[model samples]
Target: MQKQWLKWFVVGMLVFVGASICSRSVHADDSLQRVKEKGVLTVATSPDYPPFEFQVNQHGHAKDVGMDIELAKQIARDLGVRLQVKNMDFNALLVAIQTGKADLAIGGINPTPARQQNADFSQIYYYGGESFLVNRADAGKLNRQSALKGLKVGTQTGTMQERLAKQKLKGTHVVTMDKATDLILALKTHKVDAVGVETPVAKAYVENDPELKDFKAAYQLNPKDTGSAVALPKGATTLQTAVNHSIQTAKTDHLFPKYLKTAGKYMQVNTANTSMWHYWKYFLAGLKETLLISVCAVLGGIGLGVILALMRLSSLKWLSWPALSYVEVVRGTPMMVQVLLVYFGLGVFINIPALPAGIIAVTLNSAAYVSEIIRGGINSVAKGQGEATRSLGLTKADALRFVILPQAFKNIWPALGNEFISVIKESSIVSIIGVTDLVYELNVVRADTYRGVAPIVVVMVIYFVLTFTLTRLLNYWEKKMKHT
Candidate 1:
């Protein structure tokens, strides 16, 4: 039985390693086969841009709805699988494709040289022109291309508009944001003098809100319609062919014009779920996800942290060196970089969903800091404590487990509580890769309400209340531990 179990373990490891190698080393016709086998097609999208892609209510649930969403669904149907949409920032979309996290990505993504280098492109599914989105006050003043010089103009990062704005409006500082909504906020706050967005999206925004009532397109930036296409991973020839066929079929069936009309109908606050109660649901869902991830990450961190701390304290060079190396690497990098690496870089091998990948990344990151916290707590114990344990004839392991750990934990409990609070805040980074935490859900609310600042300010208050309450509770717990 022991031999049989060992044989099975070896086989599983081999299969995992083989799959990882195949995903990284080759880009064959295997994409469609893999999707069929999994029974789901993962599509990455930035849903803040409407008509092409944006959030809408369907079956009492918020879902990506637009021309691209339907096209992605059509492709999934063609392949005989369920469709799963992963919403994130526009820049992260190509990274998702490169890392095999998504079968394909769609937004208002253009066929640019830099993007073409990283991924494959499908046939153009939609087209729109570029124009300036300015504050109502500045609408008349910044009417021409020459008017933008020396002023700050905002666009979504890594987008064709940024490059175009740079070329056409020489001397203008082109500030970039991750999403269109963020750019809206930046423009609203007067961070930039003007923003260049696709003509339809800009018009939709100005028409939706009274604050933007005076806001209008200063002038058309580009005369020709810029084409939007579906993006696939590099060398995904077969999948690209499949996606192109889906687009052609939709166009032939006259489905795109109907999709546009359907999407346009979703552009108002008079719809269901626009009430305050519905917005609260978004906040509550986000809060639930944030707390859940933080608790799981902190628990895992404590377990692994204790082991790592022990290793670092060990006299053996082998154990201490590796633990030290891991701590340094994790602590040296920013939290967002770690999340990206774990979600995309490590995703090259195994198929990791966003939630588990987020937990694992958070766990690994938290353990590094937790290890140092624990080690400091342990060191604060007198040297005589270990000596006294040994004098009692207890084994070193038993002494550490029974005598040392209990006391060390008592000393470190307050720090552990603070770490929990820190994790709660840090978990916001997980939303970048589409984990749908508090920040991600709030973003959804902003999209639904078109009241960006209110949702952000409200969630900021929610986070502050949570951490403040947790801190007060920890202070009380620490005081009680001392009395005991």
Candidate 2:
């Protein structure tokens, strides 16, 4: 009887283990578990495009106050989770979904064939018409695509309008901006001949801005390309199905128009009259990020720069040649190009946080210059110093460590300071990829307040102050070090 009982117990344990193994597959595949675990559904967006997604001052604070915000909130509410918005460049939104940085992406994103390859799309949540917005003075002459030949046109990067502009208006130079707000500024400043965008957004800018009176929507795009859908990470079918159901529910309830009407009220409210002190928070937040990236980049650049410098200075042709090539290539290109490549191109393959990626890109670009600076500094040191170190019975590594780097750094220190300052200025480019630097926040403030020039001037003053103060201090430090 005891032997029989033991056999049954063993059988029961095997059955339980098999069931557990089966259940593991279900939990591993369930993407919704994360939403429940975290209690927040993060949606990635670029909120500069008003009415769809934008910021507005709420009781002395900037809030995600737009149609998309409301729509996302509703979806979150339906899922019994809190809503969190991650603002970034529209071009980066799909990348956010693909890398699982954001659970969902909704920014009036039209489901395009190219984007579909990278991620899945929910059902269309909203439909909007595309139209040509041109300078009001030239509206009559440049209304048609044929007339736009040879003129520069602007569109938000990675958008359907960009593709359509390329296809329909072949001769037009399609200048891309990362945000709708920037495109509007480009159109206002005559940087672009016209901008092609969704009709409602074009209408919002024209109606909201007194200066935009000179811009007019020329004509509508084709009928077939108006659907805007939410994007989900690949293999997130369960979450995608839930989002599609929420969107369908919103459509059935006429939530789009209702959200737009409510968002319009907030969008038009002039927050310029509010205490400028209230908006200081945006700059403060930006300052923190700017410092973070600049400091981190400088430190990271120093480390990598040392490595590259040593490689370039090596006796071996193999080591020196590759390092030389890398420095030349990086130095030859613009920092902006490098940032885009790392964040967008390499991001497709690697998990890159916007902050770390920005830091990494800046460090890489800086490393090239830093390497050259360090190499120059090292060469400036006397050849006798190396001989002396070797005579002291030091290894090559110990010679570099004890006798070389200390003196090289002294010579390179001032140049490194200038590099740091240049980095602080160059850091502005990272804003395009959604780093919450001063530029990014100002972009938000400009759209939210519609007082575009003041926000820009303010940010410029802040940047100038930051750079100038750092320059003066660096100069003082150099002078004091000379005495030492």
Candidate 3:
């Protein structure tokens, strides 16, 4: 009887494990059902590449309008779901899809074999060639690929063009930037001899700026290398099928030309008013987001910091050790890594939006530094004060609340204020994750207007004003505290 029972138990365990595997498989491939259930297909893209995906100011409101966005709409329509676009850095787009932040990524992605290992891709929707953008004065000399042999060539980071430039352009220095606009800026500033970009993108820049001109930068190409495709999560076969179908429909109906035409009109409108004042609404919106993230992060950091400080101060080994470790770990690493980890690492369990992720990361990062500042402030308080409270028959918690904390806060006030200022400045890093902080909007305005330095100057002035005003306010508070 015992042997028979053990045999049945083993069989039951095998069946349960098999069922679990099957369940996960279904979940992985249920991308289509997930979209329909939510009634929205979230598409991710880096909108800094024009004619492929870029933003335009429409009646004082910024809107995304490009061929890639149009294709996303087509896919969403075929899936019977509304389309929701999420703008992120180009490097973040594939990771966004892999982490379930979006249903698909359509930012003129090349469906290379290396990328295929990470995410499934749809049929190529658009075929494009490469070109090199150079100053018109040097166009005759640097027009061909061979001419770039010993010059600096700039490409957008994480792009096929970057890889090609590095691999194929022997004796040339290859520089990579996060945005196509930045690459153009580099070329114009003479930091790079030429900028490698998509043929259409190069044409768009050359048409707008007479100083720039493009010529073919040919390569020994594969079919996948020259075309753009939509990326989906790995094992999302159903979603890939639907997206491929949408691509086929667009191709059969000859809709690519129409998409490009629509994008060109928006681009023309965008360039019509390149003055910084014309895009005041964009700057205003960005300022609000920056303030919101900074204020929330600082406030939340203070609260968490107090708790951590208390934990570190505790006599209990477990509490104090963990608190110490957390502070050291957070302090030791770069904040950018923390931001990505919180945005994508924690995303494996929960889908946090970019704004909240930015806030959480900054809050957590600030807590560590704030905790150390608080701990130092607490230490600065006279030990005799604690003894005096104890002699008065006050409990430890009451002593901390009434005497120690108030004095500690008074001591740390200036440091805390400096932290607030630091957060306001450092918070610009959140732009990489698509939070519309002032810096993010600065890049958007740069791309849309194609006037990089002007937008940068405007953002720089705004940041200076903000930090200077904050410094004056902090000085005022410090004086008030001293009097108190």
Top model by TM-score, which number? 3
Task: Please report, in order, the local distance difference test score of every candidate based on alpha carbons.
Answer: 0.80, 0.80, 0.88
lDDT of 1 by residue, 119-215 (tens): 8899877777777777777767866667778999898888888878776777889998887888888888899888888777777777775555223
Candidate 3: tens digits of C-alpha lDDT, residues 1-484: 4345545654674576445434444564688998999999999999999889899998888899899999998888888889999998999999888777888998989988889988889988887888899999998888799998889999999899998898888999999999888888888899999999988898888877888989998788788656899999889898889888899999999999999999999889988889999999999999999999999999999999999999999999768876876786688779988897788766766889999999999999999999999999999999999999999999999999999999998899999989999999999999988999999999999999999799889888988999899999989988888898
Q: How large is the C-alpha RMSD of every model relative to the true structure?
A: 6.0, 11.2, 7.0
How close is every model to the real structure, measured as TM-score? 0.90, 0.81, 0.93
Worst 10 residues of 3 by lDDT: 17-26
Candidates, ranked, lDDT: 3, 1, 2
**Native-referenced Cα lDDT, model 1:** 0.80
lDDT of 2 by residue, 336-428 (tens): 878876775555456587888898899899889998999998998899999999899999999999889888877778898999899998988
Q: Residue 257 CA error for candidate 3 (Å)? A: 1.0
Question: In each prediction, how many residue pairs overlap at the backbone (N, C-alpha, C within less than 3 A)?
Answer: 0, 1, 0
TM-score of model 3 vs. true structure: 0.93
lDDT of 1 at 295: 88
